[model samples]
Target: MIYLQLFLSFFQVGLFSFGGGYAAVPLIQNQIVETHHWLELSQFADLVTIAEMTPGPIAINSATFVGQQVAGLPGAILCTLGCILPSFILVLMLSCLYMKYRSMKAMQGILAGLRPAIVAMIAGAGMSILLLALFQGALSHIRLGNFRVVECMLFLVSLFLLRRYRISPIAVIFGSGIVGTLIYTLLPV
Candidate 1:
């Protein structure tokens, strides 16, 4: 029953998530954090941190992590499948339709309309994560001084390096993890 729940929850997220992995975060949070109460808000933050630090899409990572946390390896496999199934089926069907409608003006217009909606969904997901982080960091009893500043610096540095220098993501994750460990050791907690 727990495995079924994990699969269904992620299946719903996969079905409605239109703008890629980040766009699925809020929906997953709503399901796992709010609806099921399987994880606390702080745990959700940790999930996001772990997801980002690992390889793969954020949505898949979240599904696998949450499922494993809730149940075990079986839950992880089911949730991962649920997360990807919609995209697999939708893309296959759409590819066929796209090939058939290659010269159709109406189809082209529909595709154009979808672009902005997808962008909006992605933006909403990002904002949701940011709001959660800010709210938690501000309201927590053990708030760290200048934590937001550190977050902003890391975000900016990451964006700059990825966009400008095209650093490999694996390199960034491993490098940052080492740097973060060193910083934690050096800085006063």
Candidate 2:
């Protein structure tokens, strides 16, 4: 029963989630945090961080992680399948239609309309995670004073590196992790 719930939950996420994994963040959060109460917001944010650091799409990684957290291996498999199934079917259908209507103005207009919505969704997800990281325990306790200076610095530096220097995201992630570890170890709590 729980497995079915998990499958259906992720299936819904996969079905309605347009654009890419970043766009799916809100849907994942709504299902895992608000609707199902399977994971707290902070945990979901952490999961997003981990998912971003790891290979593969954020949506798939999140479904697998949440499923494993809830019901172990089988849950992970089922949830992953559920999350992937809808996207797979949709993409197959869309690919055929897109090829047929590649030059259609209506199709181009639809894609153009989706572009901004996808950007907004991604931006919203980034802000949510930023809030979670900066205001430590904000999700669980609603505390706004517990600002993490080191994290903020890391975020700024990472942003600077990525934007100003055009460093690869993989390098930025690893560098930030190393810097964070050093800070935790060398700096007094």
Candidate 3:
């Protein structure tokens, strides 16, 4: 029953979460944390962090982690399958339609319209994560002391490296990780 629930819940996420994994964050949070109570909000945030740091899509990683926590290996497999199936099917169908309609003005216009919505969704997700990281909880519980100065600094430096110096993102990520580790170890808590 738990496995079934996991499958269905993630299936819903896969079905409705458009514009890729970042756009799926809110839906994932709602289904896994709020609706299903499979994980606490803090745990979900931690899952997102781990997911971001790891390879593969954030939504798939999240489903696997939550499923493993809830129901072990079989749960992980089922949840992952559920999360990917809809996208797989939709992409197959959309690709066929796109090939057929590739020259149509209406199709082009629709694609153009979708671009802004996808961007907005991704931006909203980024803002939510930023707020969560900065405040260390929901907005109502926000405290200045909870803000992570080192993280903000790392972000700024990483942005500078990527934009101004044109450094690879993977290098920036590894560099930030090393810097963060050194700061935590050297600074007295």
Each candidate structure's TM-score, on Cα atoms with residue i matched to residue i, is: 0.81, 0.92, 0.90
- How does model 1 fare in lDDT? 0.82
Give the Å shift of residue 21 in candidate 3.
Answer: 1.4
Report the poorest 10 consecutive residues by lDDT, candidate 2: 136-145
Off by over 4 Å in 1: 131-147, 163-169
State the lDDT at 124 in candidate 3: 88
In angstroms, give how far residue 41 of model 3 lies from its true place: 2.8
For model 2, name the residue pairs that clash: none
List per-prediction Cα lDDT, in the order shown.
0.82, 0.91, 0.89
Model 2, 1-189: lDDT tens digits are 999999999999999888889888989999999998999878987899998888899999999999999999999998899999999999999999999999999999999999998889889878888888888764556464788889999999999999999999999999999989998999895
lDDT of prediction 3: 0.89
Count the clashes in each prediction: 0, 0, 0
lDDT of 1 by residue, 1-189 (tens): 888889999999999988888878889888998899999887988898799888889999999999899888998999999999999999999999999998999998998999998888889877766655544442334354534554555566776888999999778767766776777799863
> Lowest summed lDDT over 10 consecutive residues: which window, candidate 3?
131-140
Global lDDT of model 2? 0.91
